[model samples]
Target: MTQAQTLDHTSDQSIEHRIGTAVNQNAAHTREGLLERLFGWFFKGLVYAQIWEDPVADMNALQITEQDDLVCIASGGCNVMSYLMAQPASITAVDLSPAHVALNKLKVAAPRYLDQNAFYDLFGHANKDSNIRALDQHVLPHLDQITRAYWNKATWRGQRKQMFARGLYRHGLLGQFLKFAHALCWAGGVKFDKLLTAQSLDDQNAFFDQEIAPLYDSRFVRFLANRRASLFGLGIPPAQYDKLAADTGGDIIAVLRERTRKLFCDFPIHDNYFAWQAANRGYKSDGTGPVPPYLEAQNFETLRACVDRVEVLNQSVTEMLAAQPEGSKSVYVLLDAQDWMNDDQLNDLWHQITRTARPGARVLFRTGGLTDILPGRVEGAILNHWRYDAEASTRATAEDRSAIYGAVHMYRYEGA
Candidate 1:
């Protein structure tokens, strides 16, 4: 290839190109492809203020040990930070979104300089003026130049400062999406705060059946729900949206209703920080309620000590894994990213995963559909190195407090 061809080829493999390729699976002129591009655009900026996946269930599946090396997709960095509590040897977090990379870096660095209470005020309550202050004084200096530049970008700085002062989880695409959904429910005479007040599962069930279920049944809401673009706020791409629709046999409304029901009724509100975000758009202000393990008071010291062990990569997980030595990392947390991949991408990812995995390595991921997505997608020759833990995956799926995903799966690398 000539120099000009090489330059053009390099441009096609840029992070922007990867995101485009991952999301735009359909024909460019098609409706599905249009929504895919829209999701890609939205995903370019801040998509998640807090990751929706349950780090607790993830840790349970990983059973991370001191000897283990982990690589995870950094959504909001909660799981990456929380994994420190497991005493992993090191963690490498990679993401295509620059916003997510910045957020993850901030979360990893803040615990080092701030006291537990101050840390809680910033990330836990996530709505104090002190958070921006903490970012400037404590976390900012520790963050890498790229992360610092991301937060300092004049266009994004104000919105991010406002997010920190108001509530970290109350901003972002996912946050704003939930805010809109909440308002839609309120307009329909449903209140999430009322559901939070329920003390028992039966009460939660009653609240959902009476108040929440009807909103899903609304013609206007159902119409909105049917469109893939409506879910862009949830950080779900068109590819995953197809699986979600398929999960309910094309009844997207039913899928929405059932997922929402699981989120509200499957667990108690006080113990579920995911529920807190769904209801209140932030963690408890009083500090007695559940929060991410990294935000817990007892884990503060652990986070501070282990924060140095984290490596934040602003790129695709497949690219990051490809740079690692053979049999390097033992734990992989894909966090539903495979749902975004095409057949070639999936095969490429598994090849790297199987290449980099150590003995008894565990790869944990979630899906938007009930079925195993890897089958017939990832090449069987490549898959020969791994075995699916069906029973553990089912239990993990049930144990996941986030309650949004259809399934959580585990693949163990038992060797070829």
Candidate 2:
């Protein structure tokens, strides 16, 4: 069966049905606005190519230990793999999107079965012709029936497995968006490649100031930045757009400029794969530069050994946590998923989180705006069970290499 057919066949399952209901509710909600409905539609079909939030900062916030059991929302599945580097006792990766669930399962399964070079070629190099062969011979045999069916189906570009050959970074919503951005940079006479050659922070800032900063000033670029739809490529829902605009005093252009500056100039390029991917459209080809924690050769064996500890599930975070035994999990990673939710949804989610959290359990998440949404949204009784770590959150937000989010929040459950 084709990709569409597979999706249709699976639409009635609990996870898919729940996600579909949420999408429809968001679209019908009067307060969500037209743009938000559009964003909902876009997100329902979107597959994130890479997770934008910095996992290094996340690790610092969560402070994962061997005794800890983690639950995180799996987006592109990169951070889940990176979290394996922490060697948590286990990780339950929950996502409403089947594509994300499939991707996470693939990541977990690939490292265990494939050899180093083959694994690297499939994900790190991401453009090898042998990737489909590797997937067939090594990866496919190990995937679950659902995940196997998802990847085996034919896509517009050929089989879904062919995405590895074209460069995995060039396939999804974010990937296609970045590709368009590169084309725009070329049209604007900005040499984005110069960023890859910079040896120092000074050189990085200088390059950005000379070649990159000017692109944002163009009328065409500024026009695009002002529109809510233009940001769907970056996984920014309409609610997130509103938060960002409110935070920036409604100057979207200035907000984009500042965020882009931080991405390009605020951090050392050698260690920031986020910057490397932005500039070159993939990771550093030589393998000496920055890559995701899981892709680093030193962590390969560790990830392989620990891969089995992760369980990828297609369900809402609230649903998953409600099904878990109370106090079963020690760490929670909610990656800006709350921005898409309403007050009731937030209350329901936090209720489950608070119930399932062990003593001193830490919940770390990012926000589109700097303001705390839970204070007024969640019930005071449920809210009182958690102590918000403002200082650590501020520090983590400052130290985050991604520089795309407005705030990183850390909450600790007090436990009865």
The TM-score values for the models, in the order shown, are 0.95, 0.94
What lDDT does the true structure give each of the candidates? 0.86, 0.85
Worst 10 residues of 2 by lDDT: 20-29
What global local distance difference test value does model 1 have?
A: 0.86
Give the Å error, residue 12, model 1: 13
Off by over 4 Å in 2: 1-17, 20-34
Clashing pairs in 2: none
lDDT of 1 by residue, 1-416 (tens): 99767764674357577688768888878888888888888887788888889989988877899999999999898889989999899999998887888888888878788999998898888888878888888788777765686676675347455578877887889988988988987798887767777889999899989998888778899889988888889988988888999977898888888888899999987788898888888877788888989888988898899888999987888898888899999999999999998899999999999999989899999999988899888888999889999988998999999999999999999886
Tens-digit lDDT track of model 2 for 1-416: 99866776677465546754454435455655566656555665545867888888888877888889999999988899999888999999988877788888889999988987788888888988899888999889888777898888887778887888888888777887898999998898888667888889999999889888888889999889888789888988766788888877998877788888999998999889999888888898876889889888898999999999999988889988989998898999999988878888899999999999889799999998888778988999999999999987998898888888888999999876
